[model samples]
Target: MTGEDIYFAGVGDVHGEMYEMLGLLKKWESRLSFVLQVGDFEPHRHEADLQTMDAPGKYRKLGSFAHFYNGSAVFPYPVWFIGGNHEPYGFLDRIANNTEIATNCYYLGRVGTVELAGLKIVGLSGIYKEHLFEKRPPIEEIDRHSNADYIGFTENEVLQGLEFQRADILLLHEWPRGLMTPDNRLDVIDPEMVGNEYARMLVDSLKPRLVLCGHMHRYFCHQIVWPDDTITRVCCLAHTRSGSNAVEIFRLSGNRSIESLRSLDER
Candidate 1:
């Protein structure tokens, strides 16, 4: 790691595609850094509001709702995740709102920080209320496992409270702006404009050198249009090509400059 503070590895939209994580882990796991999965762990079930019983007269609570490597492989570093619309609210939302569950692995609600390789990592689940429009469908209406639309934080709410400038990296579930695609499939019609509006807001204002996100599924990368002098690089990474076999390794250090920064953006 250069004078650059730390290194970050990220992935998004695993739609139950656990196999894709191995290739990346195989190559980069030995480095001194951290790993982050933005959201969409798949195989998730929302049992919170689904009091309705299944065939056997037993009510089905959310199942297949936890975040995993999917491939069931162990990552070399501490693996952390943000909330996706697919996570179990009975598990995640409760943890975010309840102070007691703050540190529990099962529920790493909204924003939490991890320090490694001399970097501070801050994270937020994808299913925040602001990302879900009010006129948009209810949480249960859109996805099966989540109880309500992300009724928790707005983009400003998240930005105002957090100490972004101090953190080395930020992990989120959706894109900020110019990053979202106009033709997302889940809408079934008009675009929902989720992260397109503000993921950019934090990146431009906070100026963290790196931001890792999911939700768009396609590959993406961008530099912060406006940034602080100390935080010179900005990147929006692309998702792995396929869940079974895809990976990207990113390197950073204080010595980082224009030459190597461009190299990281290559396909």
Candidate 2:
């Protein structure tokens, strides 16, 4: 069976840019079924700032977004958001949405699964801060450390708490470069071994068919070979520096591709 065509207007780290993006999305609702974003809604909260602050109430704009996002006053599609390290809460898995936007925004926190048109979608969000960056020093020092603990904690939460041991579609925020990819090659990486270790564990253990992530936003969309001849399509979308992006689309008729899908983004 051919894969269905599902439109996903996904973007992240827009922070103050949500209003502009939201307007554009309204015009393109006819062609999309859902949307996805990887985190960093607050452009101000860099990795260094997250560890130092105890209560990031300053970034309450997200709460406002949640209020509107969960409401039907304005929106045309469902939004699937994974917690970025910038997300100030713990286990962001709760989801509330309205039908006017046809939007069902769900944040899986660490790990989750979604079924659309007979396809399975799984995800894990938020940073593994407890293990990676519990203590905050200076801004300079925070950068020196790695977000592996944060990544690992998220993974642990998904695997241990959610019971998503075997996912057909896995979503993670980090990419580990040290483990053997689904293609059986050593996935070379930099920074903390734990970050690589954590992601690699999913790649090695879960062996999903597709994995979408958005942490090292350098524009990544490729395939990895895992054990048992399984291939994992890992995608890292580049957030719009100006506007929104056409990141997701679904067609039950199997007419899915970046080329044929409608584009309403005005970025």
Candidate 3:
């Protein structure tokens, strides 16, 4: 654990499948120092009343992560994640700003940077919504409805993100725009389903060593060369709830910089 190399695991959307996710991680636990999920971690338990609320099916509250949140189950390794469109905002907001949900599990807020296992990790929860980003709305306004909160972010949150300069890894629920195929004629992702433009702008500015994201439910990887001649590895993982071998590993040098990237194919 005190060497020039550190090993960690990264995954895509959990969508409240904690047990299923943990089952897969079990094999890698001995080698991995920690685990990180991209989004849709669903860190709350639904009350009886909320479960019966008159909201639409999608708006209905579900507490899949409640077991972990309430100490019914414990994550064997250090677990970290951001919020997604499907999480319980009420519960997450209560413990905002990297609060520990369990002994080894923590929530990375709307926008934040943390040092873990000698690596700098930055996280931003939720995808970029046009109404919130351009209108500069407040979280208070979005809090009026349960679904609105899932859209995520206030003007302040975006502004706070601008302050983050560099990180060893950046985690977000959305993908950066303009990621293309090897031929570069068209986008590797859906044009209409592109992610945060501001996030892409930050990638240009911060130039982190690694950027991991979810929400697309598919896997893609690209090597981005920044203006400073530094390289950033961007990867989108498959939904861990269904995707086989959901965990991806990365190695870091003693200087706290990434040395190599590993994916399911490599295993």
Reference-based lDDT, each prediction: 0.49, 0.48, 0.72
Clashes of 3: 0
Task: Give candidate 1 regions above 4 Å deviation.
Answer: 1-7, 42-73, 96-108, 127-148, 155-165, 179-194, 225-234, 237-246, 254-267
TM-score of each: 0.62, 0.61, 0.85
- Which pairs of residues have clashing backbones in candidate 3? none
Best-fitting candidate, scored by TM-score: 3
lDDT of 1 by residue, 1-267 (tens): 345555556666554444455454555556636556776543343333333211122423233323331333334565566666544444444444213221222333566666556556666665445445333333344346334445334554466425555555666776665543444333434334546555555665555667777666655555444423454243444455554222345665566432222355643
Stretches > 4 Å off in candidate 3: 1-3, 48-64, 134-143, 182-193, 255-266
Please give the lDDT score at residue 244 for candidate 3.
59
lDDT by residue (66-110, candidate 2, tens digit) is 445445334456666555665533222122221122135455544
- What's model 3's TM-score? 0.85
lDDT by residue for model 3 (41-157), tens: 766565642331223676455545677767778888888998877766656655668888777888898788789886778888887876766553343444455455345555567
Q: Using lDDT as the measure, which candidate wins?
A: 3
TM-score of 2: 0.61
